[model samples]
Target: MKDGEGHISIYIELMDTSSLPTGWTVTALVNLFVFDQIRDKYYTVPAQYSFTTDYSLVRFSAVKLEWGITSFVELEVFNDSSNGYLVGDDCVFGADVFLIKQPINKVNVLWMKLYPKGNGKVAGNNISAYLCLDNLTLPSDTNIFVKFSIGVRNVVKSTIIKSTSTGKHHFDYLSPSVGRLHIYPNGNKMKDGEGHISIYIELMDTSSLPIGWTVTALVNLFVFDQIRGKYFTVPDYSAVRFSAVNLEWGITRFVELKVFNDSSNGYLVGDECVFGAEVFIIKQPINKVNVLSLSGEGANHLTRTHIWKIRSFSSLSLDFYESVKFTCGDFKWWIKLYPKGNGEGKGNSISAFLHLDECNLPSDTKVFVKFSIGVQNVVRSDIINSRAEHHFEDLSLGRGFRKLISLNKFEDLKNEILVDDVCIIQADVSIVGIVTTK
Candidate 1:
């Protein structure tokens, strides 16, 4: 440190740390030039700093200039969910500091609709469920996450068929058949509504539920983030940056920062700069805590089945070979994954082998890489009356991604979630010839 100089240069980068944006390299050196305007002198401060390594895999690091540490600013690190903690109000000594990160959590698929129960009175749909969340407790106002999932609560198998015809057919007038309607005389069945879903809720996630602690049901709501330009609010399970709710399962309404030009309750669009939203969930104080993964298989997991011709109930591994295939000029891939062992065992989350219909591929065309998984061959089983929704989402198709249509949503809205094994996907390879790129 030098104090006798008549000039000083301000710099925050150091050579030994790591390479950064710019000035993240080099050394401290400036040329001093002197000119005579009657004893006038000029000096140039060419400050240089260098890093000890690369910054490609780091968030940030800092070294304190030891000066009794009375007044100093330190580099802070936090989860990416913080996008920017939308710091507006504060009463702090670190109290205002919030950390965020990407979110991870499980969701149970459930479909519900408003329908009439007994007495012909309109009522809320009975939601069958077996849902739970890990790390549902909040450590501070900063960490929270919400997972979006539906549970098939109280669903009963249905028995109804419309002579779904195919194969050899007969035209009574000329022997030109129009498919067969071989229905099982005894296989037709249906079950009525079970009841409203009510999964057990416990405060402390442990080997056993705590004595009296309870996790009262909670939910969070959202309007829109004009700054982010997205209106949809997706619940995030983990604090990881990816989840829409920033994993704030805290069950609090989202809030962005802005100066009030009018009453807050009356704030309108284009009112303020949205740094980020905040979600919250407070927990009752407890001494020791242990976070456990859901006891059985992951949440919202679907049951699969096989056998194409049988309109079976929810069964495991329903064979869909006849419905899946490739078409000329089309580039797509499908994947399926099922528990390696018992349906309730825990193991690595890996995908099943991808099978392609090479015969239909327009010769020499390649398949685009994608992120997808499914139940290979699912048919209705005697146990589970219906199959779980096969989850798939498209990532810009040219790269081989298929668009995901929340099939679960459609089923609930259409009141068709209780049907037996149904094909959730139908890739029309015949239309490959018309796809165009922008």
Candidate 2:
């Protein structure tokens, strides 16, 4: 059969399992195959299982008598011409089963311990638990991938106290343990000691990492405003270094308690709030140092201007248009215009934006730019304009006004901003500084 993800499935079906003996059982190693015409060979997937009448194996039963591979081969690989699994619109599939004698039963048990009073770094503040495996029962080199769940039960009410599951993890000779720690008594710790909101990013299990490992990253934290439908973001302009000794970085007082709790602010609604973070890891070259050069702020600053002339402006029906790329401050930039405006200005005004070509900039590079976007008046010296300054990086590649000018004012006959169905857009860009890792 074919599965939903376009993969072939194979199953072993048993007939009349109720007529078998009480302890009847058969163990076998099975292999499913797909014939490759080009190679004149078979692609095989192997698995081992035991079909039994006994109740020990929970997965096998009289009612459920079939078991096998669900993903035998991908449809794409089976149908590709070059691979030749299918030729002349015909394909071959088969299975092989080898009977095996019953093997000795072995049981591996995992031990878990809970500290009701908490432990280690979380003492007195939270509860903790650890999972342990008896390495002496297995070979020294043996490794197992395991996933399990832990829960605290309420004995009096016969209900759940708290429960969490550990995602898959590898257990080996060196690192044979994995567990959870510092589960707060009440709930998640969204607030700091001062009653204000707090947030941070921490590297998990840093003790297991190799020595001398370090990571440098730029971090941005955000809180969602339910009323505004936008994020209130705080960003770190510079990168923060994280190592074994310093595993976390963030803001303790992300927002004042009074401000965030206010109903009008829309930060917390229905006793729920959303918080998120963006961390960009900066990779550095081994055995080399990075030097950042900054351009002077005042007299030594560099500036440039570009004018875009849009002919047949009324004929533009698209949502937005991009001007030809121009160079400034050793970087490429382009002007973006929305004929019918966008976002808040849609259908009522004209929108304009300046964007940096982030693809050409290094991952660790950031450019601080001050710029002005305007529409030139053909009949008068006055130009409708707006100015802003921003630090351009991967996350923020563009900045501009959503309502550059009201459509009524821009189209007024006396303004002459648009004459002969041609309009002019101008941008004055100045580079304040630049930071880059060499």
Query: Candidate 2: lDDT of 143?
Result: 49
- TM-score of every model? 0.16, 0.36
Candidate 2 lDDT: 0.65
Q: Give candidate 2 misplaced runs (Cα > 4 Å).
A: 1-301, 413-415
Cand. 1 TM to true fold: 0.16
lDDT for 318 (candidate 1): 38
Listing every candidate in turn, what is its Cα RMSD in Å to the true structure after a full C-alpha superposition? 34.8, 23.7
Estimate, for each residue in 133-247, the C-alpha lDDT of model 1 and write its tens digit.
2223322222223222232334365533211111211011111111111121122222111221111111111224344433211221233345455532224211211122221
